[model samples]
Target: MLGAGLLPLGVLLFGALTDRLDANPIEHITHSTGKWAIRLLLLSLAVRPAQRWLGWSWALPLRRTLGLLAFTYACLHFLTWLVLDQFFDWEAILEDVAERRYITMGFAAFLCLVPLAITSTRSWIRRLGRRWISLHRLVYAAAVFAVIHYLWQVKADWLPPAIHAAILAALLAARFRFRTRPVSVAQSPGGS
Candidate 1:
C-alpha cells in the first residue's frame, strides 16, 4: 500500500527530472499533485463503502495510508503554488487565498487535512480517543471543497471535475444509505 501511495509522487518527481511535464511545468505539477490528492482522498473515503457494499475486507486497512498520502500530495500542491508559481511571494499568496474562490476552496480543503495528518499516528490516535473520529469527518467537507475547487478552476473543460463530484456524491450518499459503522476501528465513533 505504501508503494502504491508513493507511485504518484515518484511519477511527479521523475517528470520533473526528465522534463516531461507540460510547457507550463508549474501548472502541470500543481494540477498533478492536486488531482492525486483528490483521488487519494476519495479512495480513502470509499474504503468503508467498499467494505460494506463490495465486501472487500482488505479495503479498510488502507484508509489511513491513503488519507495520509492525500495530505502529502495536497501539501506538495500548495508548495508548488507557493514556491514555483509565486516564488515565495507572500503578498500574492495571501491575495490568492483571500480573493480567488478556487484557491480559497483548495486552501480550506488543505487546512482540513492538516490536523488529520498530524493526528494520524498511533499515539495521537490513542490520545485523541473518540474526538479523533469527529475530527476526521472533516475529510468529507474537504473532499467537497476540493471538488468545488477543481470545478471552479477549469475554464471550458468541466467533465473531469464533474465526474469526480458525482463519484463523491455517490460515496457520501452510500454512507447514509448504509447505516453500518465504518469498517475502521479507529473511526467507529458512535458504534456500540
Candidate 2:
C-alpha cells in the first residue's frame, strides 16, 4: 500500500519540483530512481539471509513488497530516461540501448526484473510451486547486471560502484555458503 501510494506521490512531487530539482533535472531524477531501485533490490535479496541467520520469520512478508518496490523504481528509472530525458524519441533511445554499454546493461537488468516481478504474485507462486524458486533466481543475474550498469556509467571515481559491487558480492557469497549448510543441534551443557 505504501509503495503504491508513494510512487505516484513521488512522481507528482518530482514533476512539481523539477524546475528547482537540479541543473540536469532529468539526469538527476534518472540517477535517483535507479539508485533507489538498486537499493531496494539489494534489500529484497537480504531478506532471506536475515530470516535464516537471525531467525526473523516476520521479515519474510516484506520481501515481496521490497521486490515489487524495486521493480517500481526500475520502471520509473527507465521511463524517466526514455520519456523525460529522450522525449519519447524511440530512434534515439534505440540507438542508446545499442551503443551505450551502461544503458544496455541497465536495460538488461530491467528486463530480467520484469518476469520476476510478474511471477511474485501468490497465484503465480501456487501455479509454479517449486519452479517459482528457479524462476526468481533471475534476480541474481539482475543484480550483476545492475552493478555492471553502474560501473560502466562511471567515467572516473569508481569508488562508489566498487563499494556497491563488493557488498553485492558478499551478499551473494553468503547465500551460496549458507544455503545448503546443515543446521547442527546445539549440545546442552550436560551431555545427553
Candidate 3:
C-alpha cells in the first residue's frame, strides 16, 4: 500500500532522472506535486466514509499514511514554487501570495497541512487525544483550498477542477449523511 501510495513520486523521480519532463520542468513538477497532494488528501479523507459504509475498520490505519503522504507532496509543491519558481525571494513570494488569489489559496492550503503533519505521530495522538481529531479536521479545509487553488490557477482547463470539486462535495455530503444517520442496535459497537 505504501509503495502504491509512492507510485506518483516514483514516477516523478524517474521523470527527473530521464529528463522526460517538458520544457518547463519547474512547472511540471509543481503541477504534479500539487495534483498528487490533493489526490492523496482526498484519499485520506475518504477513509472514514469507507469505514462507515463498508465496515472496513482494517483500512483505518491507512488514513494516517495517506495523510502524511499528502503532506509530503504538498511540501514538495510549495518548495518547488518557493525554490524553483521564486528562488526563495521572500519579498516576491509574499507579494504574490498577497496579490494572486490562486497563490493565496495554495499558500493557505500548505499552511493548514503544516500543523496536521507535525502532530500526526502516535505519540502526539496519545498526548492530544480528542483535540488531535479536531486539529486534523483541517484536512477538509486543506482539500478545499487545494482544489480551489488548482481550479483558480488553471488558465485553460476547468474540467479537472470541476471534477475535484464534485468529488469533495460528495465526500462532505457522505460525511454528514453518515454522521446524522442513527446507528441501529444490530450495528452497535463491537458486537462480535
Per-residue lDDT over 87-134 for candidate 2, one digit per residue giving the tens place of the 0 to 100 score:
989999999999999999999999999999999989999999999999
lDDT against the true structure, per candidate, is 0.93, 0.87, 0.93
Candidate 3 lands at a TM-score of 0.93
When 2 and 3 are scored with lDDT, the better candidate is 3
Q: Pick the TM-score winner.
A: 3
TM-scores for every predicted model: 0.91, 0.86, 0.93
What is the Cα-based TM-score of model 1? 0.91
For model 3, the stretches where C-alpha displacement exceeds 4 angstroms are 183-192
**How do the residues 27-113 of candidate 1 rate in per-residue lDDT, one tens digit apiece?**
999999999999999999999988977899988989999999999999999999999999999999999999999999999999999
- Residue-level lDDT of model 3, residues 1-112, one tens digit each, is 7899889999999999999998999999999999999999999989999998899899999999999999999999999999999999999999999999999999999999
Cα RMSD (angstroms) for every candidate in the order listed? 4.2, 4.1, 1.9
Q: Which residue pairs come into collision in candidate 2? A: none
